[model samples]
Structures are given as structure tokens and as C-alpha cells.
Target: MTPTDLPVLTIDGDRVDDLESFTREFSTFLDDHTWRGNLDAFNDILRGGFGTPEGGFVLRWVNSDRSRQTLGWDATIRWYEENLKVCHPDNRADVRARLDRARKHEGTTLFDWLVDIIRIHGPGGRESEDRVHLDLR
Candidate 1:
């Protein structure tokens, strides 16, 4: 099938400052029109059947540069902090180390995490069978 035939979901990056904001926007892709999932949940959504067509969809991100900066190191640290609070005790140390890395500007930013998730569902990715495509405009 041609690219135009598949479903497409677009989120304006300029409007998202952090993971919460991104989730709020990403909820537009869910069947219930609301978000209650974490990063893993976001990945599941990409697998389709959750409002997204099982056949797959195109994810369009506009003004992504601004988003990359906004969700950079500081956002990464915040993400880890939130997880640290409710994470399983055994995982706390790992989360703490990640947070420390973010503080040192040494690990993935929220934007990177998001793009990685999306790409995983794209061409040549592990789930490339889904036919999900990334449109970073």
C-alpha cells in the first residue's frame, strides 16, 4: 500500500514542554482520547489497535527542534525523579544512576527517548512489520 493510504497522527512539538505535556498530546492517538500510560504504554500504542489502525500509522512531529531542546537534560532528570519516587525498590538504584547521568548531561533526553520509541516501530526496526513511519517536520 502507498504511504498516503495509512493513518497519520500529528503532534506539535512546540506545545510540549515535558513528558506530561507530550503524553497529553499523544493521548490524541488513543482509542479513549486520554493518556494513562508511561513510556512503555506509548510503545504499546504504536503496536496498533488502540485507536491507531492495526495496519500502522505515520507519526508527524512538527517543530521538533524546539521540542528536543525543551525536553533535554533537565527534562530527562525530571523523568527519572518521577520514576524514582514510585519505582520498585530494586530499580531505584538504576533510576538514581540515570538521574545522575542526566545531571551530568550524559544520557538520553526525553526527545531522544521518544524518537527511539517511534523508530522502533518504523522501517527496518524490530517491529518494522507494523509499517509505522516517522515524519519529523
Candidate 2:
């Protein structure tokens, strides 16, 4: 299936505090599938949840910086690994390239990359709501 065919799951990062809550909320948000205590199941859910697996899906985490800190670096890495495993083989290379870009650029931190994964995989493109903007008052 084409990238545009993939579903988009937009997460409000402000609400995710820990893995448990994140998982709970995520599952609730999808409202069709449940985690089966395995990365593979998690992967399946990531691909489409109750939706079609062939098309996969995009997970956009808003306020990613805060979410990254909340999830921690190790968790983030684990997430990346799991995400890669679930990605279609044909798309893996492109995903890896995105990861590399995030690693190489000082401005595009790991947190940024985590969020970008969603945009790269789907037709949502980029939106202001996807990012966390800080305003000094």
C-alpha cells in the first residue's frame, strides 16, 4: 500500500506520563485492539491497530520533547527498534535514513526524530500541531 494509504494516529504528548499510561491511552484512543504483552503485538497495533495491517499507520506524538523525556532515552530506543521491526521491508531503508538524519543534526534531536517518523511514513505532511512550541511571556 502507498504511504498515503496508511492511517494516522495523533497522540497528545502532554497526556503521556509513563509507559503504562501511554499504552493505556493509546489503546483507548485506537479503541479496537489491545496489547498482548509482546512486542510483536505492539508492532501489529502500531501498524494499524484494528485497522488494516497492509496499509500500516502513522503515529504522531505532539509535544514530543516532553514525551521523550517522560519516556526516557532507553525507552525511546526500544520504541525505535520496535517501530523499525514493524515497518514494511521496502520502507525500512527510508526509516533508517530518517534516524540517521536526526542523529547527525544537532538541531534535529532524537525527540524531533521520534515525531518525524510519523510524518515520513504518512501523507499528513507537517503541521504546527505536531510540534511543541514554547512561548516566552
Candidate 3:
């Protein structure tokens, strides 16, 4: 199925009451699809969302910039750290390396990476204009 044919996971930044609530909602959404609440699971889902028949999905973020400040930076970093702790030792190094790279990338936040990844892998490949739709307004 095409990326547009898949379901869209909408995150309303304005409605995020707190981190706990956002976490709970996000986790619940992931759980509904049998996601394991880890980077691997997240990556798998992304892969599936991008034309993989097994995983088809889309993501829409409203007020994404605000969400970045409210639930993007620290929360995503903490998630990476927490998931890394539970990951296999062999994989930890690679995960850490990626995390380090992500940190070093100027002006590129986790959310930005996520959106880019989706665009690169989805439908029209890297040049696909239908990237993760973010409503900054």
C-alpha cells in the first residue's frame, strides 16, 4: 500500500498536557500495533510504514515546533538512553554511536530525523515531497 493509504498517527502538540500523558498516549498508540516500545520497534514500524506490506502508516504532527520544545528534545534523548540500557550489549555501541551522531548534528533534532527518515523511505523514495506533514502554525 502507498504511504497515503496507510493510517496516520496524529500527535496534537497543543493538547499535550504533560510528558506523562504524552508518553502514555504515544505508548498506547505503539502498543496497539504490537510495537515493543524501543528504537528497534520504532525503526521496524517506520520501515513497514514505507511501502512494506507488513508495516503501513503515516504520522502527522500539529504544532510540531511547540511539541519539539515540550516533548521532543529531552524526552527523545531520554527514550534513546532508556532503550539503549535494555538493548543487547552488542547493539548498545551502535545505538550509542547513532545517538552521538544525532547529538552532534547541528539544528537537527530527533523529531527532524524522524521526519526525514520517513520521507527518505516512504513512497517516492528520498525525493518524495510527501514527507511527514508538520503544522508549525
TM-score of each: 0.92, 0.43, 0.50
lDDT of 3 by residue, 96-130 (tens): 87667656643455556555555664556653434
Error of 1 at 40 (Å): 0.8
Per-residue lDDT tens digits for candidate 1, residues 7-64, read 8788998898888888888887778656664888888888877787778888888998
Listed per candidate, the RMSD to the true structure in angstroms reads 1.9, 10.1, 5.9
Off by over 4 Å in 1: none
CA lDDT scores, all candidates in order: 0.85, 0.51, 0.55
- Whole-model alpha-carbon lDDT for candidate 1: 0.85
Worst 10 residues of 2 by lDDT: 128-137
Pick the winner on lDDT between candidates 1 and 2: 1
Pick by lDDT: 2 or 3, better one:
3
Best-performing candidate as measured by TM-score: 1
Question: Which parts of model 2 have CA positions greater than 4 angstroms off?
Answer: 1-6, 29-31, 52-54, 73-137
**Pairs clashing within candidate 3:** 48-55
**C-alpha displacement of 14 in model 2, angstroms?**
0.6
Better of 1 and 3 by lDDT: 1
RMSD of 2: 10.1
